[model samples]
Target: MKEIFEYRALLIELVKRDIKKKYRRSILGILWSMLNPFFTMLIIAMVFSSFFKFAIKNFPVYLLTGQLIFNFYSEATNTAMGSILENASLIKKVYVPKHIFPIARVLSSGVNFILSLPGLVLVILITKAPVKFPIVFSFVPVLYVLFFCFGVGLLLASITVYFRDMFHLYGVLLTAISYLTPLFYPKEIVPEKYMFLIKLNPMVYFVDLFRDMVYYGKMPTLDEHLNCIFIIIISLFVGVVVFNMNKKKFILHI
Candidate 1:
């Protein structure tokens, strides 16, 4: 980790490059970061709320909270999966730690996620969703989710170096995960028999944590806090182990 701090300038440059490259050709530029989630929430609320008739109050805020958390995970992991391959030329020419590439990708996505928070606040104000003082500390779960994503991003970045096919497979897997998470629908709508599957998904707990603080305006339960911490620890352990094991061989494969 000291090595990463030593290369902090490089990481910062990489993150800035990523954020710039994402918006380079666009007219709105960084504003799109805020607009994308805002529009997504609007479209989702229109389609699901009107067609499905969810019973939840302030459904747009509910959907936005879940979407923000899940979208960060999806964007971070997907971008991180390609981080190694995308920076192949640099890796070949440099001796920098390969782990930085995925970490940089996750940080860049996190910037975008943070940029989109104002959209959530807008939805909250527009819908008049209950807001409380405790919601100010919502960053606690957000930080956990970020660490969880960084760990998963590391694992994906390492694996994709050897098995390029994993990229395509992950897209399909993410789609399935999106549905399995209660992003667009209410958890109560889920059938009793399938509730176990939802409980087993780590993303469910993360999303629930965000919803509890932001949407429900309450602190996450003790179990919810433990679940987030447990997943963060386990994922980081697996990610670092897999990444270290595979990084030396990356040059050969790439």
Candidate 2:
């Protein structure tokens, strides 16, 4: 931890470089961060609301809230996992804390997620979705997700250094996770027998918390708090332990 703090300036620069590099020559540049999710929500809302017909109210808001949150998780962990490999040359030539690479990737993705928020507001206004709870409260769940994603990233960064196939497997896992999450569908649609599946899905609580604040306009219940705490603890504990164990071996593998 001290090492990471000692080199905090480098971390800040990496984050800034990442954000700039992501949209360097693009015309829209950072605005793509906003439009990407907004356009994605448009396609999803159209397909689901028109053809498949989910009975969700303000379907655009519901879809975007979940999509934006999940997109951050998917993008953060994905980039973080590969960050070590991406900076292989630097690791070989320099002595900066290896942790910064993955951390930087997560922060860069987070910047994109934040930039995308204005698009959410535009959707809400155009759709005339009723705002229920204070939007500030939505950041509560976002904090939970951010930490959870970092933990996952740390763990994956460590693992992928050794087993390259983990990258491919993680992609498949994210696809499965997206389906299991109730992003485009209502919870009631799941059969009673499969209710346990919903409970076991970690993203369920995070998504529901964000939805509650943005779409449902309600405070998260004790159950939500407990679930999020448990998931975060488990993810961080495993991620930190595995990362520590494997970080020493990263240079050889990378």
Candidate 3:
């Protein structure tokens, strides 16, 4: 931890580089962050609305809430998973905490997520969803996701160094998770038997908590809070242990 704090400048530089690199040739630049989510919600909502019936009120806002939280987790972990290999040359040439690469990727993705918040606000305004003090507490859920990403990102980054196939495999996992999470649909429609499946998925808590606050105008329940705390603790513990144990072997594999 102290090492990261000391090298924080390098971390910040990497984050800035990632942000700029992500949109280097793009015409929209950073603005695309906001538009991407908005358009995604619009398209998903339209397509799903046409195909099936949903009683989910303010479907756009509900979808947006779940979409934004999941997108951040997906983007952060997917990018962070390859962080070690991405910085192979630098890691071999200079000494830096190997964990910083993944951390930087997650932080950079987080910047995009933050920039995308205005789109959510815009949707809320358009939908005229009730905005109350609890809505401001939406940040709590996002913060939970950020830490969740940190743990998952670190573990993936370390594992990918040894097993390159994890890169492709993680993509498949992300696809499955996107569906597993109730992004476009409501939990009410999930069959009773499948409720256990939904409960087992960690993203459920984060997405549902955020949705509860942002879309439903209520604070997250006690169970939601406890689930998040447990997830982060277990995630960080496994990630840190795995990363530290295998970090020395990274040079050979990378």
Which portions of model 2 show Cα errors greater than 4 Å? 51-54
Consecutive 10-residue window with the lowest summed lDDT within model 3: 49-58
The ten-residue window of minimal lDDT in model 2 covers 50-59
Tens-place lDDT per residue, model 1, 84-159, is 9999999999898999999999999999999999899889898888898769889988899899988999999999
Q: Write the per-residue lDDT of candidate 3 for residues 161-202, one digit (tens) a residue.
A: 888999899999989888889998877889999889888889
Model 3's alpha-carbon lDDT is 0.91
Residue-level lDDT of model 2, residues 164-206, one tens digit each, is: 9999999999998898898888888889999897888899899
Global lDDT scores for all candidate models: 0.92, 0.90, 0.91
Q: What is the overall TM-score of model 3 with all chains considered together?
A: 0.97
Which wins on TM-score, candidate 2 or candidate 3?
Answer: 3
lDDT of 2: 0.90
The better candidate by lDDT, 1 or 2, is 1
> Which residue pairs in model 1 clash with each other?
none
Every model's TM-score = 0.97, 0.96, 0.97
- Cand. 2 TM to true fold: 0.96
Candidate 1, 107: how far from true, in Å?
0.5
How far is 86's C-alpha from truth in model 3 (Å)? 0.8
**Pairs clashing in candidate 3?**
none
